[model samples]
Target: MFKKLSVLAITFVLLLGCLPMLSAQAAGNATAKQPGNSNPLMDHKLGADPFALTYNGRVYIYMSSDAYVYNSNGTVKDNDFSALNKINVISSADMVNWTDHGAIPVAGANNVNGSAGIAKWASLSWAPSAAVKKINGQDKFFLYFANGASGIGVLTANSPIGPWSDPLGKALVTGSTPGMSGVTWLFDPAVLVDDDGSGYLYAGGGIPNTSDPASIASPKTARVLRLGADMTSIVGSASTIDAPYMFEDSGIHKYGGKYYYSYCFNFSGTHPAAYPAGEIGYMVSNSPMGPFTYTGHFLKNPYTFFGVGGNNHHAVFNFNNQWYVVYHAQTVAKAVLGDGKGYRSPHINKLVHNSNGTIQEVQGDMAGIAQIANLNPYTRVEAETIGWNAGITTERTQAAGGPVSNMNVTNINNGDWVAVGNADFGSSGASSFKANVASATGGGKIEIRLDSATGPLVGTLNVPNTGGAQSWQEVQTTVSNAAGVHRLYLVFTGSGSGNLFNFDYWQFSTGGDGGTTPPPVSKVEAEDMTLSGTYAGKITSPFSGVALYGNDDAAAFNQYYAYGTHNFSVRGASNNSSTARVDLLIGGVNVGSFNFSGTTPSVQTLTNVAHATGNQEVKLVVTTDNGSWDAYVDYIEWSQ
Candidate 1:
């Protein structure tokens, strides 16, 4: 199972049956305040195409899709995809403590729309919408999804939440409308049921049409077609609903005699400088079927409440007479030259329309409003080590047990080392701590112990040193059997006797519930390389030796030599991808790998054990997915 580790503080609050009326002006100015609610009524991550349905007096917000894996250059990061691609439902009766209904509309499940595809960058599923109404006078739930590359599919369930399935292999809209012919990219299907039991499906995110006057040559426009009473097919010519800056996922709401079309504009694409950061915008149409006008940038900013990036891809809906806007954003620093892909988060805020008539993007994060039981034993922190012989200190200052800070080894220091010991973490259990380290220095080793454990011999580990310093290798260990406010110490026991071997910071974890399950290792062979899928050039290792490689500068690569984990030598080869992508595949399945983009590669290891017995066929694949840049594999290894 994929997991997401968030660092925000957690809290809980009981919801009273009241919502404070938001003022339009105040709502627009309601920047996310610091020390905000821990669990705001509705907030999501990497979420898009948000669809909301009020059932049995409770409100459930569903996202059409979300994604966890982030790719840069050619390196892929192992991340939680539960919040993306799969369907997640969060529900609340009092607007607090929303329940996560895991994944619904799961691919390949009974009644689901399509078959699950292989690990493609943007596969699985996309935008989702739900419609609940009386079918033959009995209430039924209709779940709509955009499956595969472009087809709009449908599923049915008895309950609002569902184990929805689509027995038919093809999409209803594909067969119903003649205009949706050939292979086309039309997704994000929003279904609106009319008074007479008929419904219209609004499909969006298509290439610009040049024939129509209203058709702006932008990647945002909706393809509208009415559906028959059975909801099986389209009812008319594929009429295009064009709007000013109106492109991408859109929500259609019928209000006081007019149709309010809320659409998302790639605010990042608005200016040449802002061509990558997306933001939400809105437009209004007197008729859901006609011309719409661009309103304004709903919520466009350079930074997030978490000091990351702004939000985009929104959905707005009404629950019990209250209108709410749902969207996504990233809470991390962004890349200047991205892979043309945007980072996102799911968000919800009460919709406050201006007296003059306009809608704003949701503001004031409610993520701070709720509390959930934390299952993690120890908190994890990511830190950077700079300069030569750098030391990061983390004294036990909090009530809980954890490392005070992290240490990184970026400069070559054959004589440098780390010193770790405990300080004021009031004595608890036999205070157990663990450290995870990575380097390419073959002879690197770690000497660790608690001040209360025993003699100078607490726990010592020697890094397997041999591979080129260009690639990073890793070692994970747990040190225990200590008492009192135990001090855990980490000292690089030099190549032999002195602090001659330098290293990155030793990561410390106290009382962490991190599972002991090791990651799976995928084995690949040199024969697996095909001209189509393989990186252009290759490295022939002389004799029996292991090679390593990554996207790192000479300075960072040189520092690994003093760590004594793997050898500090590395060879560079050409490839392209935002990050350095390392792949080890067994039967074409990726098992061990490391990915790095923009910043220097994180100190980690890709473990492929086939080389241990000298029976492994290794094929290294590099990527140049990003258009402008290229790089090389850092090094290789020979073992037996």
Candidate 2:
């Protein structure tokens, strides 16, 4: 009996020892986000009502900012959308790694630009839509948003990630607008710029007010209107789009010369076999101002895929010759809070358009679409571009003399790291790495790793105090054994610290050869190079020894070794009253151009110019003639 009791006691102790392991297994099962999953785009913040814009080989997603709301007891409350006065923006070139461009303070009492909002007249902003049109040979971006359920407002900017401003200082659409008398909710705008450059705006949703069942079945509340040439103004009165079971969330896309109008199906009444409640349904029309025919639904409700039900919102776009749809789900919130609480995060999946003009039904899941392209690590990559990360946040700040407001990775502590997916270091491998960084306190070390955060260590860059957090400087470190395509991880480490450093952008060098030695930082004097054309001449300058000056002249530097992408800086000046242009060519291929106006000789640097390997002929050609006055060149520097 004593032996049996001892055996039982031992078994009990062993079972007690296994409790934490079983509990950990249960916690791991509850984690909605998994390693290598591309869904939700980012885990640092929550965003909803995703709209995508493709420009210059990148896809930019604009979303309504969804933040946590807390109860009086310090627990998370259901999302009320009261703090949704800002719109978040993120972009990706390869789809797997997304760069957080920060948020646009659209409407609020205080904002990034100033105390007043970008659109100060509007109290709330939600469900944003973005469109870019070339006006007067320059691209102009327009952002449209819902001002609660009452009206719609528009903001304009010079770039997609904007420091935007209200053009009219008022709402664009309201109850009094012509032909909008029946719209139950005048919001959720979607804009499309057709192939012919004509722009159309699709807005409005909600069931009709009549008690007739037909009204609920076919609520003719959605509206489409012609946008003016400027895209900021309405060209004509809105027209009705009689969509069946219309709830909200209007989406528009053109495929195979046919217009598709998609919206959420209303859940108020019994949905027909053809229409399911909370799913995304669509209609087809030949014209933008549509007398449409109801088509089939392409996307089901979130509950159908994620096991969590909520309102449906989406945007369909063609990026890199492939169709994709970005939508919002409560997966992240549910994973954290055990219940979603209505907080949302954006997700993306492949969208297919069948050959017959019908869109293939999209199956939304945690596994997203494969990356279409590999990221080039040779060029300057924004530090905020992340595939996965832990213990980090991003903030908006301006890079020194940068044209637009930029975002930097911040709030980094020990063990924090950011990863970039599928970074192609090429066959030559990388010899060195550099980053624009700043630190207010004692700085930390950046551990350059490959594959995973704990993977092979390639190099380490020690960051130093740069006086202030915004006072930036370029720091470099030698890299070795980093080649081919791998997930690049920037792991942070330091002694006693709360925060370490702020990172802006980083680049890798290939030494202009396959060698592991760091590339020489040198300049090729333009005056010493071979010159041609009618006005080619050499002159003496105080800034630089001998300078090359000419109009319609070309200076050639032979046997110049260049690899990957490098910062090309030209020290020159132009006395022309108008802007003078100089073209840079490598191996007869035009890489880029530089424009200068004033006579003051200063350095003009162009970052991230792609170059081919081996020895090549580099040329500086004065393509633009500024009267008899010529553009002067002192020397041309690369990778300095």
Candidate 3:
């Protein structure tokens, strides 16, 4: 999927009749591979060579941006891999709904930052592999990408979806690197951080040129090298692996105390019964740097699953204790353009391991894996976290004082909307809704709906002119009859044409009196609370003027309110530790807790907490010390 192919124009025009049939199918139908059906992940854009990274409770996927090329006459041209210079990042706690983090400007002249890429010397970036390692008490992320099959470049960031930078300012692996001799096309890197805190890198693909044709069966073209303690440098020279019928895409994973070295078999010559052409084959070994034995093929070519075959690229990883494989196909492009023209989009399917340590054959199709967890609507959710979307696009922009960059739902017009799946609004239901929005032009209305885009209308938020597009304002509206687990939709409505407004994030409030009055949800900013403990202090961020951060730190809020069961939620960041947690105490009695993780600030809730009426004290105490003990708390909300 990383390489380019030439397609005839006549063949493309002849396949135009398939679009009508595809469009006629219902979205929820099993045969349809649309956004709601969960096949190609997303249909708005194209991406390929998907690599997965699991941190905390989320799975982040890094992909090579697959923008469609065009002929001079404005017809779609074949994907030539020349326009690929950026990497797309998207993540989800639930596998079905994903949050688009936009693209990382990796190479070439015009990056997303308006200058040269993070790696200015590289011209192309493709087939990215991402890994996270703990260094100097904090998590450091490393991204290895192919610089057009000639070399591999590395970028480092503090977060998975990064504001990345090239630490070395050049390619990390080149043909000149030691032990790279006899290696053809030194790219397609797969990295592993072993359980022992050691790192290993696997790369190098393509068949060797020789007079003896049998060399195709054992190319010996793949290389394995030990990564230094810093994970940016090499420990020693590289070592070669004799992968049978190896072509491209070097994949590695450790399971059942054994190292699995997998690759895509080459299509150049005749293959044996054991090795299949253009399919993924694996070899097993006891060590990361291995004298390995060839196993069996698990995944067939994309043609077997989607009927549109090209080169296959894949990554295997474990998320939420379940094994899954992410690969690319031309399904989305073929449905829209009638012919795929070698353009590709990413897809995921479940992978199973037999008790004997052998992998079960994977079945790849339009139906993807089930959602591992339900989404919490009571917290602030990014508008880009979409299960399905229509007539809209996302862009990376800087909020007034937020992170370096944040993605927002944009390019919205009338009849456009975004949907989120399996949102648990609880038995009490939601009473109100809030959104962070902005607009330079006349603003529009956001209709909160259930199930489908045109489903039941629960509430509506009228957006106003916010001075500028980056100027954000929090707006709220009363909600009614929004309860239980169901798909949530934010439908945009407006007058005139072009983009109406930009949506950053949204949250819904529960436990209000079902009436015309607004929900009785009370929010207390962290900085305004009384702080105690040795390390507790206030910090500043874009979302809040002051936020609380510390280990074993406690913040107390004393207020007079009605005695009843209420939902308690907090907005915060985990300081890059999965074990971060905060205990909620009402009048000095522990009621429930809120868990935090990942670098991005999000909201987590502890619902149905009993509070006594009259003046009472509520406290939040950080209980975990695994990370830097620098976890943050932006605000706490109580809704009844």
Candidate 4:
């Protein structure tokens, strides 16, 4: 027998260090790329379940802000919560820069209907899907999202973000009803406005952990319900749309004569970091809601040929006729480097439509950039609860944090107030306060008030303390509602110098819809046509616009520059009819403008070209042109 082989202990040590090494290498790779070279037409982390619309030359991104929390690394902090089940609109131009339009109010806190306050599911809002079309004689938007903690609910407003109201406060599609208790009713809504201007909603994808593992393995049982034209209730029996495997965060796209269902599996919806992350795949059907047949996959592990991980929560948005995919990538080394938190940063990639009209993911680039048409208006803010002590007194107080408890600060003299809490109350609701103070002298009292943009004394209360180790006294009061939505403060006022008190909690209950939110819009206007340009070198295949040539000889392979009306292109190849092997740039950034060449010239086309807004510029450069054998392009027309 061969000498016994011992697994080297040294090998184990090396393997242990592999994780840190790999992590460091990954982080370093992201930073090694040329800065500002590979960027998206536009980008942002403000919206989720991104729904986009291009109307009258403007592109708007509609989504829910939900809640604001620190990424584990603590790099980003803000109060941009959708403000109580509200929808937010962000508009952009060039698909690069964006502008936050604020929150689109569907419902606010303490409203007769909708979810708000300290309720379990009321931290922020959830998925919001939007469709814009003309109803009657005027243009209207149908924005749909689930209300309550877990079931499907309906709210309507003429605009994307609005003073939305639910005439019926019950679940539009009941979740886990008596007969359906086998599963937890879930809601991640996606809306489709058909050619007839009729609206149809597709919702489902939540599973109760109580189910047997075996039962969960079967995808056929997963539900996908269809809503009628009104979208107020369900139509036909809830049907299982995605076949073969159950996938959540589903989106629908109709091209040519078929409907494609883009979805992701392995997403648990709760802790986004749950194991087994997910993979992006699609299903195809002849109708909007169908017994979709799972086709091939789209996005998988960008680093490995066979490994698939971290691609979920997706949407298909089109700006100026060009399609793009907005999805969360599991891999975000930037956030990891910045803070060590791993929640993936949002990503948007250009999409290609197959000759048959099916969509494909653009490839080659691992990272892209995004810009906005306008700046997000809300000021980003963060607050942490801290312990407070009254001067020379053994009295200390705990900060009441979160929505349920009213925040308060105490331990001060009369005419003196102190801030005990910090948070941007970005909605309409009642301000709550509670505290107690010990009276150092007779007639000593503690008062509570608010000092905010619209405040000086929101509402006050005089709470008397009976002195000496007395149980904390309660001070209950509600502040006035501010006009629109703005930051709010909770203040504690007390009487008698040197007298201090302790605050318990403070919160604001949103009332009515916070206010209006418009989708991000770009200042640039759509260009009417593409312009001819020159090239100085050999261009990559799958390029757009015109392939410039240094000499009319035309056969030259170098000095080929390509130009296009838009900044989107595929890797190795394209699906539209533009040019290939041309160099393109956006503000000096070399976002890939060409694809690899193989066989025939790859197709390239442009959509949503912006009109020359005085502030922006578009340039195309060519290095070499591959003549005859593989034709190069010069420019494209608006109509292709």
Candidate 5:
């Protein structure tokens, strides 16, 4: 949505087919395998290594979040180790808008962040990739990644964003592993499972693709292994791939019964090719372990359309029978800091293939691919799950606990909002809205808007204080004709103060637009009210108690009563036409202020008083001079 009007308005007449242009003079050509067609997609935070999964009509992307510290010149400072402490998951039905599901927590730990600031495997924590498999009739996700670039580690979880566990309890493939003797550059792990439930792993680096030539070793290899059914260990010995100009970041996949192996290639003089060094090249083979035929360049972004960061890594996935390429670019960091060292983001584009099985030269995109479906808002949706946001950032939900994540977007100041794009309200339409929220201080209002932010106001639910930020409660409000396709915006409006409240999740219902279900409440009479302290000197009984403006601030009410309410009617009257003010006190907190300056001496009502639910002392204190500061309380009552 931040794109220029020219880019936004331009409709691309994309070429729909890829031609197999195999390199005729290629070195190390084995046998031709197959040709193929194939998001910077995220905006909340920067991420790289787009391991894409097309599951149940949705694309779930796993990413390596860059937590780099850059200097004034844009170069990373210190040890760039901390940024890879964790990984994150984002998903989408449509290609343009994506939902950030927060950091993917390691099952037994907090988003890979352990006690203090370190993770169990901090070093090999960069470039993440994963594959989903079904075991025992249920789907399971196997996540593979490099740990500090030293070894390959695997985590197994039931869901993509995990409650995960270290499957092997150590690096699955280490330098100590038999065939991995001189292959020191073992990182950027990619994993995929085939139609028959068989899994494969691709990894290796260090020797040829390093910026520092000294990091290259003698036996630099791009290694592939037949993963066991468990997906944690190798089935047998690893096979070596002798691809011409194959560098780091090996991406492998099976499409149309053909296996495609892709990697980064340098634009060096010795390796003459169409795509430059900072782009990508791929080869194909009939077998999983490729005695492969080197294909020409497939992807090249010599000058990043997103910005200036190198090291091309990518993944190809399909949804609704259409193929796509997901790659990382260093755009946001460079655009923000004037330098893009140690930072990168993800982007996606459609890939079309020729009848001969060769992939089209897929280019990068800015507005990105099309969204296949619309989001539904009548169901319970996670608050931390966002398509896009403004003036807000995600944080730990609380101290990391069992299933409750430490990663929920908090610190929502006034005028801030989060958008859930293209929510389908269905044909019936929605009549109401409900949200789970908590406030440490008091509360605020949630303005529900459809389509654009300043569009129609569907409803406004006034959120009440729920003890603390971690204390959760559900509040409902009414909505109007909120039907059809539109972007759902949860706009927070409070006293422009500091942090207002923490939001959990929200849902719209066809009914219950009449506010929340009523809670048990009772009415207390004036004579039934208890009074504290001795104020007889300035007080007299008209029927009950009356008091003149007190010279002393301490001497006040007779007794205290306990009560709780969101709002209630206070039955009382002011003494005269002069200005009369009183503070309604509850639970050692000033619950409300009532001004009956010009009202007559009749039973009156005060409503919508927001206060906590608990039995506590309720005392009324006189403030300012107004007709001897006297008012009679008949009965205090509330519906909920």
Candidate 6:
């Protein structure tokens, strides 16, 4: 539970506006090509219980990160519930471009405050719901969560991303607590604050041991309780509502003058998977505490249609004058490729209500939501603000000796990239790029590419040895054409056979016309091409920027040419320690060792080499001095 701060209790009043009507065909197909965000808006991690809170102008989605017991396979690793102790909070104004706000501090057993450590909830943190209300003229955000059916807890903060504290240094509801003792699953707590400033807490569900037939037929119930004015304690006795077949994941909200109670249920009759991971069912009542009328069904499981599905939890809210439904699915292929188990990711889609005020069923889409506004590159943008990324991960470490843990891109290697999408640079376009970075093994550069990783290079920020990885330094590079709204990929290049560097944040200046996406280039991946001495592990989407890592001098190999002289270029990074020379070999013979710069990757061209066409294995042998030991290679390309 979180401590209270000053938060003005604000009432949610639906704003009037014209919205695009939803076609019925968009309801059942997970591949539905309608206007919506792609599933797994968060591809880097697994999250569940996606709760949407529209505070002020931005919408923050609070969820349970699957790292607690995360496994790439469909099954939770060792079922270690403690791994789910933390909660992730990501926000977006346009509902498409999300900014990760690190994590919400949920303390575990005997954990210290004012720091980001593990062990917040003893059992685990699952199905958390957050709401911001005005308290004494100031706005305060309240986070409601549970430790995997162990008990229910609360945490409060002045802002969504906060210095959180338990209102009560323990769970607010427990199994031994009066009416709660009868129910086994005392988790998935959902809290709703009515416009009248009244707060309601709903929890308790069925035991998930489906193998034991006796457990399946056990009577199920999801109850609601009136929370105290101080919200830290219960105000009255729990009222058991008839949420038929409601297994768990209870969510409540007030919309269109009606109290909408949404939850996960086993309506399919066949217990498909454990706990019958099925569809989202709803029930409506006139009062927040009511005799709810089950409204049949609204949303189906994406796993059934798209081969990627899991237990579903969701939240519905209106943002930017339009209503949306936010839910989690096993959208990443890591799970669906197997038996359809493992972690879940969040997704958003346009939610339109029927003519009679009943919301219609919705499906997942690739387009996501439309951009709310054009991004002004002139302002500072966090490198963590990623629209699409490959071969990279993030971490929270002390920033440049500062106590504040800033989230930055880690695990950087040759070819890794982060793409910030749809940046609108009006007519004045951008002229330069600046970035704050750190690297233990210094020397590497950021190629400012547009649209794709190998797209048109607009600018290059050459990085100098800034002391170490956590050692922060700002580097700026000039650009010619970088204008308008398009995907910008920051591709990392350098020499080291190991990690390249870390990226903090970046910004662009208005000086030149924006560039356009470059046409595709033809080249073979290192994993598919030749192999030789001192090379590192094969690179993959993990660092989407490149495909391979060269360690030192390699054995010879062949690369084919069209029997005539043609120019060719090399793309890759090198060891951060030195500027080594790599000899371009054709038909297992030496051409010359190209003098590559330090760690950062750069393009080097060799003109007029004649060879026969079919496929020829290209070899890159190292020619290094005592100081310069090795070099890295991404791809060997021939000029058009």
Q: Which candidate number would show the highest lDDT if scored against the true structure?
A: 3
lDDT of 4 by residue, 1-640 (tens): 0000121121110000000101112211222222232222112122345566665334666665433344579544422222335555644444433333445445544552244322232323456677765433234555666563355556665654444556455556565532223333355667777665456666555333313443333344345555565556566666666333343566777777677776555433331221222445677888775767766566543233212222246677665456777654323233334421222323467777888655565552534533222111121111112211112111223322222112233333434322221222333434443333334344343333333312455556555554532334444445454323222333334444444444333323332222122212222211222434233233444343233344321211111212122323322222233333544444443332343244344445333333322233344444332332123443322210
Residues 359-379, model 6: lDDT tens digits: 787766556676654444555
TM-score of each: 0.45, 0.77, 0.78, 0.46, 0.68, 0.69
Q: Against the true structure, what is every candidate's RMSD?
A: 23.8, 11.9, 8.9, 20.7, 24.1, 23.6
**Which candidate, 4 or 5, has the higher lDDT?**
5
Q: Scored by Cα lDDT, where does model 6 land?
A: 0.62
Over 553-591, each residue of candidate 5 has an lDDT whose tens digit, in order, gives 222223222222234555555556565555665545554
lDDT tens readout by residue for model 1, 1-640: 0011221111111000101111111111112211123322322223444677766444566664444344676543333333334565655433432434435634543423345421122334566777876554235677776654456777777666665655355566653466555213466677777654667777755334433433433544466677766675567766666544444566676666566665544321233322222445555667555566656555543244434442345566765456766555443102111321233334566676766776654454545322111111122212121100112211112112222222233232333332222222323432233333444444565555444223354456565553433233435555454334333344444444322222332333344332233222222222223322322433453311122332221111101111101111123322333444444332232333434343332333421121111122334444322332233444443211
Which candidate number has the best TM-score?
3
The positional error of residue 509 in candidate 3, measured at the CA in angstroms, is 1.1
For TM-score, candidate 2 versus 5, the one ahead is 2
User: Could you tell which candidate, 1 or 6, scores higher by TM-score?
Assistant: 6
C-alpha lDDT of residue 577 in model 2? 52
- lDDT for predicted candidate 5 compared with the true structure: 0.60
After superposition, the stretches of candidate 6 with alpha carbons farther than 4 Å from their true spots are 1-37, 68-82, 110-121, 176-178, 207-220, 267-277, 333-340, 400-405, 511-640
After superposing all C-alphas onto the true structure, candidate 2 shows an RMSD in angstroms of 11.9
lDDT of 2 at 635: 87
**What is the C-alpha lDDT profile of model 3 across 1-640, one tens digit per residue?**
3342221231121111001101212222222245456777766566788889987556788888756667999887866665677788888767888888778889854453358478888887878999998766457899999887788889999988877989998888889888888887787899999987799999988766533467787788899989998888888899889898887889999999999998887776677878887789899999999988888989988888988877778899997567999888888777767767777777899999888888888899987976655677776678888877776677776665333457888877877788887787778888988888999889999999998877899999999989888888888888999988888988888994677899998888764532334346899988899988887877775355233356557988898854334678888876664646777777675666676676688899865444444677988888644554556788999774
Q: How far is candidate 3 from the true structure (C-alpha RMSD, Å)?
A: 8.9
True-structure Cα RMSD, model 4: 20.7
